[model samples]
Target chain A: MVDKSILLDNKKFTVGIFDDSDKLLHAVNTLKEKGVKIFDCYTPFPVHHLDHALGYHRTNLTIGAFLCGLLGCLSGFTLAYYMNVVDWPMIIGGKPQDISVFTSFIPVMFELTILFTAFGMVIMFFARTRMIHGIKEDLLSRRQTDDHMVLAIDNDQDQSLSNKDILELLKKEGAIEVNDSKEAFNTSLTSEEELTKILKSNKTSTKKTKKK
Target chain B: MYTADIRQPLVTGGKTYSDVTKDVCRPIENKPTPSWWLGFSIAVVLLLVLAGTLAWTVWEGIGTWNVNKSVMWGWDITNFEFWVGIGHAGTLISAILLLFRQKWRMAINRSAEAMTIFAVFCAAIFPLFHMGRVWLGYWPLPLPNAFGSLWVNFNSPLLWDVFAISTYLSVSLVFWYLGLIPDIATVRDRATTKARKFWYGFFAMGWNGSAKSWGRYEVVALILAGISTPLVLSVHTIVSMDFATSVIPGWHTTIFPPYFVAGAIFSGFGMVLTLLLIARHVMNYQDYITTEHLEAMTKVILLTGSIVGLAYITEFVIAAYSGYEYEQYAFANRMFGPYAWAYWTMMFCNLVAPQVFWSKWARTTPWFIFIISIIVNIGMWFERFVIIVTSLHRDFLPSSWVMYHATWVEVGIFLGTFGLFFTCFFMFAKFLPVINMAEVKTIIKDKE
Candidate 1:
């Protein structure tokens, strides 16, 4: 049997960041031409056709929801039937464990169907996204949930021949910012003072030039 | 191939993203003028009078109201039915419009749903108070125990109503809360204080704008909306059955269900318009609840009003054609009997007045719509009164027939419900984001 490990570490990635979606698309196409395996695209809101652009398959959440709903309906029917028919058989309005019992149970069944589907699909979603409770999140940009877009490419260290060639290619393909995982992780670990100083100087110059 | 644009804007003049937030949130963020407070205070006083009357009613018992042995269900039932009918418009605007993908609902749905929940609460009070022993109201539930209260009659429309109303209220609350979570999250992000942040954060359920969360939320909303659409329809249909199941002359009609549903939608839309018109102006959310939203609601009002008018005519026609002397007499009596003034007032308010919206000016002007909505509300209440009282006042037996009048106690509780509705609404407006900030933001990136 093949080993199925939940905690598998993938290789480090290089990402060419673009503020504009069109430039991001062009960079993605260039990476595809160079046979680079892209990891995933992170966007604040859903961008049209990004899944197709990234060659990701359609999600299986809906299939999971449908199966859960089917199970729910069956369970609801079985529960109602057992309660009404086998356990305590009482007739109301001349209707008993015939078709009317099933009909009467329809609303409950519908409610259960929805409940199961929702619960099932949500669990599947959390599982797929690796969002377990107490697990720290890896953030690319704080504004990724607000207004920024990031395209990440997965680069295997052993397979890659030249770092200079990949950087040149990304820069040539109109990347506003080029970054590797190692550099980003290092930059992210600095104390608040040093980080704030660097950010402040960059912002002051940008503001001054914009004003002029 | 040229495709016809299914995605055309509903209104000619469309509002921008910031405009929507500004328009809807205006009421909460800005302080109302002295005049607004003055009007609100007047409503408050009327509500106080209603409260006093209810206390008196409780003290005096069911006999305090002028409902006699013959007219056991009087103004209280009428008011219950009327308020419940008014409650329907909110769900119709929120759930039905959402299902139909009418974008204009975005402007009015929040206030409308609030109206629905509050109106249902007010409607519930009448039946409980009218029951004499309001404390033991839970005896109606279908729980079996050593206490030998018989299981609730599944066949009884009233029992069905308990299930229907409770279910509707619970589901509506869930739907409303689910819709509100994102906006609550927005508030959480904006909160300056630790206490406010904690409270809003708890309600927001650790939402991080993750695609997974959004996906789950969307699915939940779609499913809830699906459930609520039919649930809202079934609620009023079941309420209408309270009369339709009865063998009374005017009340026993097959047309009552759809007719009542239409009337409910009409009254509901009227209430929605009433709230949104004032809310937009008071809140300074001109951009969110715009002219186009008002127009869409006006169209719904006009459509439902016509359906109700048709029902009115159909009832008269059916009574005449059936050759049932009692039914004909009841219909004739409503138009030309002791309560002729009330009947005519209802007709003029519900039927004739709504026709003014055929003109663009009547639909577009908020003040005009507001006045008309109030009239429609009055008309709907009278419609209930005319149906319940006139039908019961003169039944098959001539000797037992009598005149029924709502004593001051009955009148007080009815007015008090307005206090109940508005007070709850005012509080809701003051606290929560009256407009859904998240849903509005989703449409902000529309290419159109």
Candidate 2:
């Protein structure tokens, strides 16, 4: 009964492809049409609307920052009040420990608010994105962090896929460079220096043409 | 479609990526020459003089400074205010300018941030060294100690300064360090030695230039820039309050906060320019720290200088219009009193001088701008001197009026602070990649 079922177990695989932002968008759209889910997109610089192309929703990081800021403000006020009024109240100047204390504590409160907001938002962001120390990540393109826009697609259907057809689609959509992740990683690990040399040679040839 | 390309020059004359790396890192990797050593030695000798003076002052007591009954806060306070004011520009350039999306800031922001840190460090020393009993400095902290002392006075502006400066230092460090991470990673990738690689690698936090990490880094940086912009403004505002909150003649004014802020950016940019002009030539980063960057910064200096000039005029007007004898006396004394020479010097350097930048030639020329920056710095120091000393010299009573001057010890310490600043800066230049390598690479790739 299960043999004829349309649903199949999800299998995770990382794919690396490079193109201009427009081409990447088109490839993403084509991938969406074929029911291929995008895992992530990596680029050296930000490409506008790329998140939307990958079907990513708005993140909660900002909301987290706001909440953390509120907490920071409360903590700052509470600490100042407790220390000045309740804990060890000593009237040095004519000013007393009352509402005026709030003004004095504003600097501390401001500092704490910014500190909490920044750290809290960043922590939430990293957690949501599954980025942690020493975690090995798939590289879509070496130049992605320099100039290229990379699309990392995860084909999860576990069905037999036409690799040649996918490469053709990528090429037709104006991909500057394309490579399968598994193949690239195997080549990278086995002969890392040779891989760098190949990249360097390719870069030089491109530079030579521009010189003309 | 691209017919213009055939007519246009194909190869732009600029250093390639490898050349860029080699040129920028030359000063760092190469050994110091005799000239470099000689310059460093002079700075060191000046630093030692400052140290000797500080030691003598501590041994003798706070009485070594020329602060008398009338003028309690003398040259020490003046220098403190001066250094702190100078420190403000760095933060303004790095944080505020970044938020405004000023692309020209990229050339000088790293060095400017470093200057801010060092200047703040120098400013911090004055308060502690002037405290006489430097060991008891921790009493300012809110924590409970063995001494039956209560919590810090939250009401005092001085205490507020302690909090503000410490917070500014910490946040600025984080902002600077976060910006340095990518560049440090670049250095790590280029390192040849195992030890150098390990340390740089450790600080680089295992950065692999992964797109996922870059995505996170960009978001965090944006958020930090957002937070730091307000924090920077608040810091200087709080610093200004150290004077503005006081009831003294020159000190008591609403115009002080913004005036101080403008002066800060003016001086800070001047310092940045001074450093970068030398660095660009010495380090061979003329392309990175381009003429366009200098022009943009020159515009900022001119704008801030005008604002400062307006503040000066407003201050005099406010004093005369207040109908208060002390305020009137303070303003008149600042212009036509014992410190008048210093006042005019400051006016000429900060207010009248920066007006030259209005001309295109002044803004575009690095050497001219560099000299102007030095003048602005001197003018800022004089501004602090005029404010602090001139006001205190003759206060409420005419009988208690007296002239005050900094002793040789005070001068040495002030010069020594420069030693501290430049020593750290020289070391920073030697060890770390002064430019944000990754950020620069991103800009370079944009041309592609």
Candidate 3:
């Protein structure tokens, strides 16, 4: 059961881009104070307390990691036990092949625990974040992943603020650039069918541009 | 956030956030430089040599190499230990240093972790081929099979190694790739060419750098670091157990775990120094991988080298104090017996050479450190050889006592692993941003 909030889905957002993380943080705080709903904020690097300013709860991913770790621990113990005790217990050099010699199983158990925890946590993270190879991203600005910190306000979430008013507010609070997300992104994220159509069109257009 | 009075700026020359991306991603963005071409060609030639030797080994069987009844585990095991030891600095720098809140690590950790992955790949080759029949390598896994439900030995340290090495490699890779995602996204966005955009975007996995994603990413990185700290220690400890559990005198010491772990870190740092010294200079990363960074690494080399030195002394002292004839003979034989040259070489390289780092100039000087780093790598390699060969060359009876020398194929294969390492490193440097631009941006003085 993946949390819906973790996914960055198709939405009409008024995106604000700031050059500095400090400025972005302040803009986010000011927007929150004025009761403007922030859809999500993206930064080139992690800005301290930006999540808190956006009124986001602390991520429960650690809890997921802990559970996965517990699963790994159990799996490790079970595999070792079943293999050594029940399956084929060969007596080598007069040493006992019973549970009393469980000390010997520690290394394998430890390794399995780490292996499972790491893989499991990463899988869970990817699943929750909707991050996968070759997926089309809704990039609001080219510099968003470079130097800019982006604050996106979904227009659907709060109908009180117009796109122009939001842009003005963002610019007033130190955002270098502000624009409607639809104008900025090449591919629209309205529906699955439309998305595929837009992607196919984008591919052909890119091919045409290459030819030219 | 104000700049702290006590802390020197991590990134010098007042680099802005955009400059970090540009500078770090320059190699990936631009055409390969002449130096890069030179290094890549050398690496490729070495890689070809590696491929040739490996194919020859596989085709000709273990008979191609020189392993005898006395020393069944010769250069194969020695090289295995050498490569694995070299792999340790990556995890130590990334996980252990991160856990300790060492900010200097941010500059070196990305490449160090990549080196860890490559070194592990090199290390794995020795053991895999050492099985003689490499096809049945899967036999170590505890699977119920047609041979009447035959399971791998749960008690054997060799089997423990199969689990430990695989786990270490996979976990290190995952850790490295997870760190690489945001940076990959940066490259994807900045990419101009259609091919670059497609490829980088694909690997970037639609990373939007959302606050929610960053929060989770931070927690996961922290947790992974916590787990990997123990995992790294356990890996070498388990590797040591392959020797410690045996009845052989020099190999059967209880101190092998801590001793091996320390030696691993020592050699690992030495290798890191060797690679990064070249990388920092070649890639124009002097500002990022500053003298302070080199100094910090040399300090680790000093600490771990001294620990290794102490371990050697302690092993000898304990062997003599134990009053056991076999144990005492092992130590004395290492120093005065047929392998005296190897023992003394290990002593000078691992123990004596690192003592020069006590001077600030020795630690700070790149040219001096580079030379010493190479020396340290050589010394660590000799240390493993001495431990494995000296213990096995004279076991119980004089009847089986025979001198061991590596055949040409064995030497070639050993040299080939360097090709495999550097080839992978060259590709990584060419394809990816060597430094973590996103992380480095956070610590940039004016930006902060």
Which candidate has the top score in DockQ? 3
What's the ranking of the predictions by TM-score, best on top?
A: 3, 2, 1
Candidate 1 CAPRI-style tier? incorrect
Candidate 2's C-alpha runs over 4 A off are A1-42, A46-48, A92-95, A119-161, A168-212, B1-50, B445-448
| Local accuracy of candidate 2 as per-residue lDDT tens digits, B82-108 | 787777777787778778876556657
Model 1 over residues B118-190: C-alpha lDDT tens digits? 9999999999998887777787665553555335444457866776777677666666776776565545443
| DockQ score of each predicted structure, in the order shown | 0.11, 0.20, 0.41
lDDT of 3 by residue, A44-121 (tens): 888889888888888788788888888887887788888888877888888888899888888888888898889888
Residue A54 lDDT in model 2? 66
Q: Per-prediction interface RMSD?
A: 7.1, 5.9, 5.5
- Model 2 residue B19 CA deviation (Å) reads 6.2
Clashing pairs in 3: none
Judge the docking of candidate 3 as incorrect, acceptable, medium or high.
acceptable
Judging by lDDT against the true structure, name the best candidate: 3
Question: Candidate 3: which stretches are off by over 4 Å?
Answer: A1-10, A159-166, A180-212, B446-448
> What is candidate 3's DockQ?
0.41
- Give the CAPRI rating of model 2: incorrect
Write candidate 1's Cα lDDT for A90-202 as tens digits. Answer: 67667655556466566545545655654665566556655443332243443333334566665664324266677677788777777776222211233566545534544
Question: Which ranges in model 1 have alpha carbons more than 4 Å from their true place?
Answer: A1-212, B1-50, B445-448
- Model 3 C-alpha RMSD vs. true structure (Å) is 5.3
